[model samples]
Target: MHSASIVEAYTVTIWEMLAVFVAGISAGTINTIVGSGTLITFPVLLATGLPPVTATVSNALGLVSGSISGAIGYRAELAGQRRRVLRLSLIAAVGGITGAVLLLTLPPTAFETIVPVLVALALVLVVLQPRIARAVQRRRERTGSPAHPDGGPLLLVGLLLASVYGGYFTAAQGIVYIALMGMLINDTLQRLNAVKNVLAAVVNSIAALFFVFVAELDWTAVVLIAVGSAIGGQIGATYGRRLSPSVLRILIVVVGTFAIAQLLFRRFG
Candidate 1:
């Protein structure tokens, strides 16, 4: 390449890297607060020309640090939840591994087809989260029965399924987790959010580890996201609660919509 072409190429590369880093920050913050961070980062990675599977794996791997950071930030709420965390963790791990295996085994075309649907589903879940919370609260008011301390088998099954999704796509996994636990476990939302972070960490870590061995990774993308997400995790932990849920939902919906469009274009356009 000529010197001018080399300079232009280098500039474009730097800008893309910067964009990925910013996406990571946004993703980590959102993941720490409400989940669906992948909706932010995955599209940016895809735009940078990564294949769908590579982008998903790299996003999962990069966000693990953010998950851990968010969990630590919520340690205060986690104080009495040891037994609960432990029980749910094993289930999450199994589901995560299962999902990861499915990702590896499935053909690339299957991923292209499935991911748009998954992103659409996750966007719907994000949009409906407030209603889901209110419904959960109403159920609490109507029922006089005490919550099952262990959340019973139903909770385990729900969490297992959510973890599998997290391991596969991880877009809105935290929303699904909080919804399930809120309905079944009878905890305050903050505490449930804390638990959500821990479980997210578990699922992300397990799936990332699995990918390290079997999947192709864009290591540069991974590093940029990891650093950015770690910072975003701290920001979310410190100030995320003060942010408006409506605003966050709007942002997630917008980004998710863009992602769906991009994926569809890649597949059919």
Candidate 2:
């Protein structure tokens, strides 16, 4: 290659690493505080020139550390939930393994085509989460029942399905987990959120292990994201809940809108 080509390649590598690092930071913060970190990181990876499957693989691996940090951050709330966490974790791990297999064996075009829709769907769930929580609360109050409806086997099934989605693309799995838990488990949202963190960590950790052994690896990007996410998770755990809800809502909406537009435009424009 010519000297100019070498210089250009070097510049691109630097920029890509920087972008991935920044995305990892944002993703970690948001994932810990709210959810939907994948929506932030995945598009940035694509814009930085990774192929679809490569971006997905790298993103999953990169977030593993973040998930661990977030879960650890919630350790206080997880004190009494060991059995629940362990049982649900097994289910999530199975779904994650299944999802990873699908990612490698299925057509890449299928996931690419649905990425935007999935992001939008997750954003909608996020945007409406407050209302959903309130509605559940209202029902409990009206019925004079603090006890959760009997989830029985159905709750497990819902979690299994959600884990499949989480394994395939983590985007807003945390939000879904919280929603389901709140509706079915009669627990405090904080405790449910703690549970969500552990379960998500399980899904990400298992999927990441699979990717490490079977899929293409981008060590530079993975390292960048891991460091960035670890730092971001700490920051988020320490101060994230103190942030203004309105400001966070605006950020999620703007970023989600941008992700949707970028996905659609890249496919069509």
Candidate 3:
């Protein structure tokens, strides 16, 4: 009987580890390619029977590892965006910290209700991003402006808001960030995507650290996810550049739509 119990415990541990690894891999691929990995991992955590707040915190922590790996893989594209990144990073950091504090203070019922609404809004942004970018590009071409589309002020404001969302429960945070950057910068989609990864990593890392000390984290899941996501992130970032922007945009729309549908079904259906 004692041996049987020990074997069962080992089997459960292995299963949980595998689940985390799968979540990490999915997160890495989605984040690097289209940016909605949280939709996968967060639900998995919730399904594991964790409380909503704990799941969100653990998901955020695990995702940071993938984001950092993704960012580094896109370092070449990020080289020229240093100034914009620096100017915006602080705002994102502040927003993330503020969001984390708010999450800790908010009641569980409130957060449960608010998250699906936020997910739906994020889906709308993802759907509209490509068209908005085309419009911005057309305007830049019409005027023959030597200066890049300097949407810095607008970007700072958007990043602050997006970071707050990221810190709280980032399902489609990357789509929102990429959309804002596409509107504001004249850079190629690849480069803007690189910036998005780094900025997101910074915001998530900060929030994850806060939760590490203050919140009850699922360490087993965190470890497996962090390792798998890091590997998957590297793969996704490297291959993502070869993909056409239109294809990626379509993928984002599909993923965002699925996420919204799932959230709505869970909440109302």
Candidate 4:
């Protein structure tokens, strides 16, 4: 009886690990393409029975590899942007540290109450991204003046706030980054996207490092997601652009809705 129980436990653990790995792949792919990959992985982590805070921390850490991969893939677009990247990265790092501190300092109950609301907000952002992009484009075309290459103070402030949010929850941050940079700076969407990836890497890496010392972790889950996301990052850079945006958005919404339902049930059921 003891032996059978041990075998069953190991089998279940393996299955759970596999699920996390697959979720990591999906998250990494989409994160590279457009961001918000946390929507895929965080919910899966919760389903695997991790607490909200732990899942968020682990997700941030795991996706670091993916963010780096995505940035590397966009190296061509990143050329001549070294000074810009460095400047923005400093602000992002500060914001990331602040957000990580907030996450750790807040009570677990507070995080629990806040996360569902955050997820809901992220879903709304995801849904409206297209319209937002169109508006940004229109504004860009109307402006006859040259855009500030540095994006000025307004962009610095915006990026700082966004990085704080990314450090805390990490969903849809890329959309926010792109929107801010698009309006503030004169650059093609592709180049802005490359910068977004780099900023994400900075924020996530800082937050992950903080979590390494302060947060409780599921190492197995973290490792699984890290490896899977790394692979998915390359795939996303190479082929994710070819994938339909509508399909990806739909998938994110579906999974996010399901996750919300599960969370509400868990909290109130």
**Candidate 2 global TM-score:** 0.80
The residue-by-residue lDDT of candidate 1 on 155-229, one tens digit each, is: 899889889878988877887776677656766667777888999999999999999999999999999999999
TM-score against truth, every candidate: 0.81, 0.80, 0.88, 0.79
User: What C-alpha lDDT, on a 0 to 100 scale, does residue 139 get in candidate 2?
Assistant: 88
The TM-score, computed over Cα atoms with residue i paired to residue i, of candidate 4 is: 0.79
Model 3 regions lying over 4 Å from their true place: 1-5, 109-150
Candidate 1 overall lDDT versus native: 0.82
lDDT of each: 0.82, 0.76, 0.78, 0.80
Regions of candidate 1 where Cα sits further than 4 Å from its true position: 1-4, 108-145, 243-269
lDDT of 2 by residue, 155-263 (tens): 6877787788788878777766765665567566566667887888889889999999998877777888898888777766666545555565556566667667866
Would you give me the overall lDDT of model 2?
A: 0.76
Regions of model 4 farther than 4 Å from truth: 1-4, 108-146, 241-269
Candidate 4's clash total is: 0
* Residue-wise C-alpha lDDT for candidate 3, range 1-269, written one tens digit per residue: 01247778678667766787898898987898778798788777776667888888888898888999999999998887787777777888998887787789877554456656665665565566667767866876898865444465777888898898778777777887877777667677788888888878888898998999899898777877788889889988989877777777677678777877776676678
Runs with alpha carbons beyond 4 Å of true place in candidate 2: 1-4, 109-151, 241-269
> Residue 106's C-alpha lDDT in candidate 2?
77
Alpha carbon lDDT at 259, candidate 2: 63
Candidate 4 backbone collisions, by pair: none
